[model samples]
Target: MPSRWLLSILTLILASAIVVACNGDNENTETSGKETDGGKPDDFVTLKMIMPGDESARMREFVDNELNDRLKNDLNMKLELTYIPWGSYQQKLELSLSTGEDYDLFWHGTPFVSGYKSKGYIQPLDELLQKYGQNLIKNIPAENFKLDQIDGKQWAIPSQAFTSAGKFTSVMVRQDLLESVGMTEIRTIADLEAFYRKMHAIDPSYYGYLETDRGHEVLWRELSGENLTAFDERNLFAVNEDTGELVNYVESDLYKKVAHLREDWVKKGIIDKNLVGNPQSKIDQENAGKLLFRVGAVSRAMENLQTAQKADSGAKLREYFLAPDKPRYIVAPSNEAYMIPAAAKHAERAMMFMNWILKSKDNYNFIIFGVEGKYYRIENGKIKLLTNDQLMYEWMWRNKNYFTAPTNVPDDVVRDMLHNDDNAKISRLFGFHFNEEPVKKEMAQVLTVYKEKFDLINSGLVGYNSGFSSAMTALKKAGYDKVFAELKKQFNEFNAGRP
Candidate 1:
C-alpha cells in the first residue's frame, strides 16, 4: 500500500489533470479565438467588416496593398473589408445573420438596432467599450449612446453623423433667382411662397418652381414640436415624449393640418403635381437647370452649388433655416453606425480597432479620409474631395475632429453639417426603447397601408379630408388598432419599470 503523503499527492495530480481537460474543452466550445496563458491571443487574428457599396480599384489597392501592413503590425491582426451593392445589401445581410454567418462588425443605422437586439442579432458593447474602447468613451459624449442602448446596455457605436441635435426644415434656393427677383433673404414660409410665385410669374417654367421629389425633400415635420418621436419607422405613429402617450400621426390633427397646407400649395401652383411621384424628373430638372428651389439637406448645398455652377457660371445656391424656436430632440434614429455581430469571434479586437482609429487625428484621417494626396487633398487648410471608395462606405468610422470640408463647401453649410444636434434636447423617452416584436404582424400591415395612402398625404400631394378618410379606413383594416394597443402597453410598461 502507498504511504499517506504519497497517496494524497497522486489524488491531487489526478484532480488537476481533470480540471485542465475540462477547461480546455469549455474554452474551445464556448469561447472563440486562440489565447495563450497570458490571456493574449496566441495567433494573429483576422477581423472582417461587411458593409454596403461597391469597392473601387483605388480602395481595393489601398486596403490590400497599404492599410493592412500597418494594421497587422500595430494590432497583430488583419482587417478585411467587403462591400455589397446597395440594392442587395439588406437582403444579403439578413440572410447572413439568420444563417449564422461569421463576421465581426457591420455598418447599420440606429433605428434598426432594436430589431437586431430583440432578435439576438447583435452584442452589447458595455464591457468591450470598458476594456478596449477607452478612447471612444473619452471622445464620444455619454448622451450620444442613450438611443443606441437597449435595456440600459450599449448595443452599438454611433459614428460621426454630421447632424445637429435638432432637425431643421430648410430650403435650398437659387440665389441668382432670388437676386433677380430683388429678394435679399427669406425668413418665413410666407416669404418663400412669395419668392416662388414671383419666379413662376416671370419664368412660367414650373419644373424650375419646386424640385422636391427625390434629391430634394422638405422635412416640414420640424414644424411639429420635438417632443414627438416616431414609434414606427414610417412615423405613422409617434410617441409624445413629455407624456409618453402614443399618437397615431396619420390620424392626428397635425397630420390633417399639414396635409391641407400642402394641398393648398399644390392648388396654388406653388408645387407641381407632375413631380409628385416622379423623382427622376426632379433630378433631371435640377441637373438641367430648370429647378428654381428645392428642400433638402443644407449640408449638400456645396455639392448642389458645384453641380449647378457647371451648368450656369453665375449660379449661386443659398440655404435657409426654417425652424429656430422648437427645441431639437437628440435621441432620434441615427442614419449610420458600426455594430458588432452577436456571434463575433473577437469583439474585443473590433473595439481595439475602433479605439485605434479614434486615438488621434492622424489615425482618423488615415482610416476615414485615406491617403491624403491620393484619396483627398488639403489646399490652404480646406480639404478637397477626390474619388475615395473606402471612405464612402467606411463613413461609420468617422470622427468629426478630423473632418474638413472641400474648398467648394461654404462655411455656413459646413457648420450646419458639423454642429447639427449640438443643442438637441433629450427625449422624455430617452432611457426607454420600444421593441415592435409584439405587434410585428400588425405593424407590417400598418406600414403597407401607410405606404399606399398616408405617404401621399404626408408628402402634401393629396388633400387631407379625402386622404384621411381613405387612409383611416385602410388603416383599421390593416389592424392599426392592434399597433396602437401594443405601443401603449409597451410605453406604460417602460415608464412603470423606470425608477
Candidate 2:
C-alpha cells in the first residue's frame, strides 16, 4: 500500500510539470508575435530623419522633449532630426544613401524619384502604406498618388497641401513707384515694358526689373503659355500647342522672341545687367528700396512685401497676374515628396509618422510652424505672428489642408489663392512623367551646353540672335536629336496608358 501511494504522488508531480511547460510555451509565442507585428519591442527604437533648413535650438529642444515624449507614448519611438542646409542637402543625401548610412526618412523632390528608385536606395511603400497609412491615402487626392508613382509603384508620400494648383506667377511692382510713374495697373507685357521704362526714367539708379537669371524662364513660360517640361538633365522640351509635338525650347521661335525682349530690356537699362548668378542681389535691392519691379509667384508677394516693409516702412507692393484676360489655371504634378530609404530599420514606423503628419493637425503644425504660441497665435481663425520662430523654408513641408494664413495677409486672399477653381485649367500632361533613362547621356551633354550658352543669353551678357543660334548649334552637336526621340517614344507610351 505504501509503494502504490508513492507511485501516485510521482505521477501527479509529472502532470503538473507538463502543464507548467505548456503555459510557458504559450507566453513565449505571444511575446514573439507582439514583437514582429506592429507591437513595440522590449527596447525603444529611434528614427533618424534628415530634412533641409536649420531648425532653431529652441525648436529642437521642443521637438526632442515634447514631441519625442508624445511619440514615445504613442509609437514607442523617438525622432532624431538632422537638418542640412538647402545648398548642401542634395550632396549630403547622395553620400548618405550611397554609404548605406543608418538613416530612416528624408525629404526629396520629384526629379530624383526615378533615380532613387532605380538605384534601389528607396523602397516602394504600396504595401506598408496600405497597412499603416490609411489616413494618408484618405487625405491626399488620387491624382497626387499617381504623380509620385513610377512604373505603377509609389515611391514617396507627397505632401497633401498645394499639390498642383499653386502656379500663380505675377509681376510684383512697388505700389509707391507705380503711382509715382502715373501707372495704377499693368494689364499686358507691353504695359510692363512701358512701366519699366518709366521707372528707369524716374530713377535710373534703381533697377527697373530686379529679376534673376532663372526669372527669364518664368517670363518665357508666362508669355508663351507653353510650359517647358524637362526631358533630360540638359534639355527642356515643350509640347507644340498646334501640332502636339515636342520641340527643343531653346531653338523655338518663342524663345528667340523672349531673348530679344530680354536684350532690348538690357539695352534700355530696364533690367539689372549684373543680375546673372547673383539671385541674392535682387532680394538685397528690394529691401533697400532700389527695385521698382520684380516677378514671382503671387502666393509669396504679401510675404515679400512685409519683409521689404521691415527695411523700408514706406515700401508697398502689388501683383499683376500675367495674362489676366485669359485667366487660365496652370496645374502641374507635385514636386515635393517624403521618402523612406530601403535600408531603414524602421520603415513601418516612418509610415506611421507620415500617417500622423497627414491626419493630425497638431503634428503637422508642430513640424511646420514650430511651437504655436511662440511662433504664431490663432485669433478669429487666422494665424497672427508672435515671433519669427518659423523655419525659413517652411514651404518645404507645407500641407495645404492645415495651412494657416499669416497675420500680414488677409485670410480670404490666402484661401482664394489655394482653393479658387473657378477658372482652373488642368494641363493635358499634368500627370505625365518623362522617363529619361534612354537619353540620360545625351541629356547630360545638352544640359552642359545650356549652362555654357543659354545662361549668357538669358542674362543678356550675349547678343540675342547670336546667343540663341549658338545655343541651338551646341545642343544639336550634343546629340539633342536622340534625346528628343527618346522623350517622344516614352511620352507616347505614357499618353497611351493614360486613363
Candidate 3:
C-alpha cells in the first residue's frame, strides 16, 4: 500500500524518463568540449558537425594534430565530426532532428534541401551570415547563397561548386577501350551509341557507356533545357524559360525518343544485361577495363581512370561532357554546406572555429584531405595524390574552393580539365531559390513515387522498347501532374522575382 503522494511523485519521474527516451536529445546535453591551448573563451570554441561517411575520422586526426595541438590550443576550440554513414545517413539525420538532438553543423544540399527547410529542422542563417560570417559572406558570391534562401532568410551556406565548366555528370570513357574499337571521337549521345555498338561488335560485355542506375532523372534533364530540380515536378520537364509555361516531360516526345534509344541499345547487347539490377557503384567495374564508359563525375572518372592506368599500362581514361561540341547549360551548383542547428549551445564559438578553418590555409587542408605527406603530398611542386589507404578519406569532403587554399593539384591539370577553353562559357543562375513550402506535401509524395517507379523506367526495365510516351504516361499515373503544377507555380514566382 504505497501512499498517494509517493505514488504521484514516482509517476512523475517515470513520465520524465519516458519523455527523454522518446526525445533522444541526450547527445547534445552530454557532449560538451572546451577550447584547448590555454586560449581565451572568445578566441576559440568546439563545433560538432554531422558529415556523411567515416571520412570525418581523418579530418578529426588532422584537426587534433595540425590545428588543435598548437594554434587551436590557445583559441580553446576544435572541430568535431559525428560521422554518418551514407547508407542510412538520411534516416539518422531525420531521427536526430525529430528528437531535437543538438547539432551545430551538418552537410546538406539539393535532394534534402527543400525537405529539411520545410520541416523547420534547419535554422535560417541570414543573421548569422551578416554578423560573424562576413568574410564568408563576402567571399561566396551573392547568387550562390541566394539560391538557398527562402523569403530572404538564408537557411544554409552554399557549398563550393563551379557553375560554368565544372558542372558534374559526364560520360567518363576508357580511352583505351575506345581506341581498341577504332573510335577516336565521341562528342554527342549519338556518337556514344555508335561507340557502344562498336564495343559490342568486339564483345557483348563491352558497353559504350554504362548508364547510372539512378540516372533516369538526368536523362530528362538532358532532353529538357532546364536545370532546376524539384521532386513535386516532372523531373525531366519544366516551364519553358522562353514561354514561362509548364512542360510535361512524362508526356514529351523527347522522353519517348530516349527511351527507344536505350531499348534499341539494350537489344544490341551493348548494354550490360544485369545493369538494371546492379548498384551505381558497380559501374566502377567498367573503369577496370570491363566497359567503355560510365555515367559518373568527371573528378571520379579521373580517379578511377588513374587507378586503372596504374593496374594496366595500356588502359587510358578520358572524359567527354554530355555534349562537348554543342553548348549545353549544365546544372553547376554547390553540393554541401555547414549549417548551425537551432539547438547549438555555442553558436558564436562554432562560427569562430568555422571562420578560422576557412581563413587558415594549413587548417583548411587538414580539415579537407588530412595531414600532408600522409593522405596527400607535394612533390616537385605538383600535387601527388595518394590512394585511399585508410588516411585519404572522402573525396568530396573538401574541394579547391572550400578550403583556405587549394590543394596541391597541378595548375596546368586543373586549367586543362576544369577550365578548358570549351568550358569557359559556362555560367550559373544564382539567387534562383525555389520555395517549396507551398507544396511541401506534394513534393514529398513526388519523391516517393520517383524512388519507387522512375528507376524502372530509366533502366529500360518497365519501358523497354516502348517510346517515351508510354514512360510519360506511367509517370502521370504516379502523380507527376500534381507535382508539376506545384513546381510551375513556384518557378514562375521565382522568375518574376529575379533581379
Model 2 spans with C-alpha error above 4 angstroms = 1-43, 166-169, 172-182, 194-217, 221-235, 241-243, 268-270, 279-295, 302-319, 327-330, 392-394
lDDT of 1 at 227: 56
Provide the TM-score for each candidate, comma-separated.
0.75, 0.80, 0.74
Q: Write the per-residue lDDT of candidate 1 for residues 291-397, one digit (tens) a residue.
A: 77776443546557656776676877777655555555544424456788877777777777787777777777777657878777889788675652454443454
Q: Model 1: clashing residue pairs?
A: 163-420, 164-420, 164-421, 165-420, 165-421, 208-290, 208-292
Better of 1 and 2 by TM-score: 2
Better of 2 and 3 by lDDT: 2
What pairs collide in candidate 2? 161-400, 234-447
- In the range 277-335, model 2's lDDT, one tens digit per residue, is 66556656766778777765545555565666676666667666555644333334356
Off by over 4 Å in 3: 1-46, 54-71, 161-166, 197-236, 239-244, 269-291, 296-316, 330-332, 387-413, 416-430, 464-479
Steric overlap count per candidate = 7, 2, 11
lDDT, candidate 2, equals 0.64
TM-score of 2: 0.80
Q: TM-score: which candidate is best?
A: 2
